[model samples]
Target chain A: MTATTPREATAPAKSTRGFLRDNALSLFFGLLFLLALGGQAAAGWADLNNRLHTDGFPPMPFGRYMTSADFAVDVAENWQSEYLQFFLYIVATIYLIQRGSSESKDPGKEGRESDEEQLIGAYAKPGSPAWARIGGWRTALYSRSLGLVMGILFLLSWLAQSIAGRAAFNADQLRQREDPVSWLSYVSSADFWNRSLQNWQSELLAVASMAILAIYLRERGSPESKPVGAPHDATGSES
Target chain B: MSNRLLAVPLCALALCAVTLSGCGAARGPQDAAVVAATHFAAAVSQHDGAAACGLLGEAPRTELEKSAGKPCAQAITGEDLPGLGRIAKVETWGEQAQVRGSSDTVFLSHLTGHWLVMAAGCTPRPGDPYDCIVTGG
Candidate 1:
């Protein structure tokens, strides 16, 4: 005998604890970022004071040094370059071809295509974010927004670096009893270019190493690489 | 996203405000010149006698050697420094007064301190050029 009964429909209750637990990685990263920033500040302060003492000037107060453009520029320039590397790498991976590298999408997948493939527009799942469902302009922009924002940040931080670098260089010049250069002149000076190029060369080398490394390197259950048993030529989604 | 973008301009404005406030009072021409001389004296006071010796007025240094029968630098000491204070005492004669000890005062004319200007505001004195000459001691 078949029995028929009315089924009750109820939404699952969302627990705050579960949400916090799920997002623990993000919280951990945020704390790590703050800690690293503090470390940079402390180390940079000591470095500046050392230079001052060597130059025969009284050591500037730590609080005053913190407000100086020299520290700001040193920090910002490094930051901008890092963001630039990631932004360029992120966008380039979409369109550029790099054979046998896990960082690249397959050569043929050059551009955004098919709502179903991207899970956007009508193909977006019921629980997808509004941006994916909204379609048209919102979806189009949201698709590339990560790279776009990073690129913008790179430019802004680079500008900040230039401004701050000018001040720091000027201070050094004053101490050395040399005529201070203008902002434009400083941008072209060996001091500015050397500091910039040294940082940039390291970043580019690291990026290149990462992209090429993923071709053969594998970590089990990691999205950054294919499965341990996967062939070296395997590309696209790791899972 | 737009709100976040707004932060750029706001940050720029704040930076400008801070910079404006931070723009230190640029040493005036007279102060600039005096600071130059005092900087030299400070170097001398630090026992860098060679550097201080380089800052002496050639004429006065030569005069002292001829009159005292010794190198002008041998006559100066940190104890004899008088004008090494941060506030440079400029004589009405447009000379920057540099101290050798607490009492001995040497007024340095423009670039007269010789090698003291070697590294831009550096004034080379013969000895403890910065120390105010001790009157009794």
Candidate 2:
């Protein structure tokens, strides 16, 4: 006789919820990004207007302030550093190891694992990615696509940061009764590097903290940490 | 498949590119500078020093008054500032702009919300910032 489990006993339910529920993490973060960005714009506008008042100038309109280079540069600078962090993390993990950290792979597996072990090409399952099944440049690209896409995004965001930063810096210079520099000059200036480095250093610190902390911490269900009862020396283990 | 995981970041990057480009498509700074210069020139031509001074950036207005040892209304109205001609060119960099007319050059600074004349009746000074009859510090 066949036996039915609790989940199987239930009829197919809300089709609409399946997509959102399955992608809850992305949706959650996406909504948070919008809220955070909106908050930034509002706060930035208010902060700018406060400075304007102190300088004996008129305050900017909300609509105009949102479109200003000041806002764009502020947003882009953070974005570039975050993308840079993810890009470095994704690429670095392939060839690096921390023996007892849950964040790192097993020490002996220091490079890209074997193709068969990765279940790609001939070893690909029926549900494998289309690119992985193609077994040529497509497969090769798919293999490194995460790092590649992240790297591309990091470059794009960094470029955006440079352009917007120059505009903002130039505006400040003009306000200070100084000459505005060219984009190339601005990028090479201490201001640009300072902004970039400050964000980068923080991200590096956070990532390092996570990698090292998870080795000794107990988080019952977080994929980032080893299982609550896991040994401190356990590596390459996730919830 | 793991391929689906890539879509989130790819979409995020696209969204970011699109959002930032929304501001990218708008180009109004140069025109705003032009308007400010034109208004200042119009005020100067009308011998309305109050209006002209009103259009002047804080530094320039204060500088003019300090140097002239007189009120802006008295000092600026009688400066013999030239009449602006048809627009020849406009160069904008960050919050600073230069509007070149057929007969004169006007420099403007965008401060806070409005553009103001930083210098008017400016001429080439050869490897230096333009020297203006009506100058701001």
Candidate 3:
């Protein structure tokens, strides 16, 4: 009788223990994020202070160091690169094909799949998302929500990187007894582009490495890899 | 649905706040630099060699004394650093500053509590560190 509960099916497990178990993946990553961020802050602060002392300057307190443009720019640069990697991966997989990589869409299934195949509009089951059943702009937007979020985050983080980087670069310029430039000038300077390109190249390398390497390598049970016995020519279907 | 819509604007708002905060941080350090430069220049103009020397970072003061072949108090007054009518402009980045008065320009370093005069009676050398008549250690 409960087999085909109309909309809002697959309700989250309600028990306290069940909730934790169900959400463990997100919780684990969230914990790691905080720990790693704290570690970076502590290490960055110590390293900066050490350099300042070597240069005959006083050490900055932890609070001040955290808020410094140096810290802000460094943090924002990495953030932008990470978001860029995810954004590119999400958007690229839609139309791009890799012969056997599980990271890519099936070779012949290129382009957006048909509405029926995507379970949208009339094809949306009772339990399908409300926007999918609504069949309009909301449905269209929600369809690509994941990629949209990644793109937005990438742009925002990149903007933050630029602003923070300008401040940090100016500070360094003054320290060297050189004049500081306007924001526009700083953005166009080689220093700014170098920081951005260096980070972007590394991220691109890592993502491309993963996408191509998965074609020939099997990770046993990981969804990123093909099954242990799956043919090397297999495409898209994860274990 | 409402919560989902709200998230987009909320994220945008947070980003705006971060960018503004970074700009604010840059402005704050420059203001601190201005205060440091003004005090150093005032000491030099008033011929308070001791006060001026006190404002010299330890390294700069040592350098000044070494270059002058005399004590800071004796050497500073002897240079006859041009009279600085008023602070005309202050340029600061990171922990360094160039304070330009009506007739003179001085470079200062943010050391500890206040800025220290690293170089006084300075002029742009074009593609080099400023040429300063007075040297800091």
List each model's interface RMSD.
11.3, 5.6, 4.7
Where model 3 places Cα greater than 4 Å from the true spot, the runs are: A1-16, B1-22, B25-32, B84-88, B91-97, B109-111, B135-137
Candidate 2 deviant stretches above 4 angstroms? A1-13, B1-51, B57-71, B78-89, B93-96, B99-106, B109-115, B119-137
What is the lDDT for B23 in model 2? 37
Ranking by lDDT: 2, 3, 1
Error of 2 at A34 (Å): 1.9
- Local accuracy of candidate 3 as per-residue lDDT tens digits, A76-141: 778778878988888888889888888887888888899998999999998999999998899999
lDDT of 2 by residue, A176-224 (tens): 4344567679889999899899999999998899888988887777777
Compose the digit string of candidate 2's lDDT tens values, residues B6-42.
Answer: 4554445444434433233235877888888998899
Query: Candidate 1: where are CA atoms >4 Å away?
Result: A1-20, B1-137
Per-structure clash totals for the candidates: 32, 1, 4
TM-score of chain B of each: 0.42, 0.78, 0.71
Error of 1 at B115 (Å): 23
Task: Please provide TM-scores, in order, for all candidate models, with all chains considered together.
Answer: 0.62, 0.78, 0.84
Of 2 and 3, the candidate ahead on DockQ is 3
Tell me the tens digit of each residue's lDDT in model 1 across A1-239: 66544332222224556766888877787679779878987888899879765654445666766676666776777877887898888887767866677777776787765779889888999898899899889988988888888887777767667667766765564444333456688779888788788888999999888788888888787777777887887766532
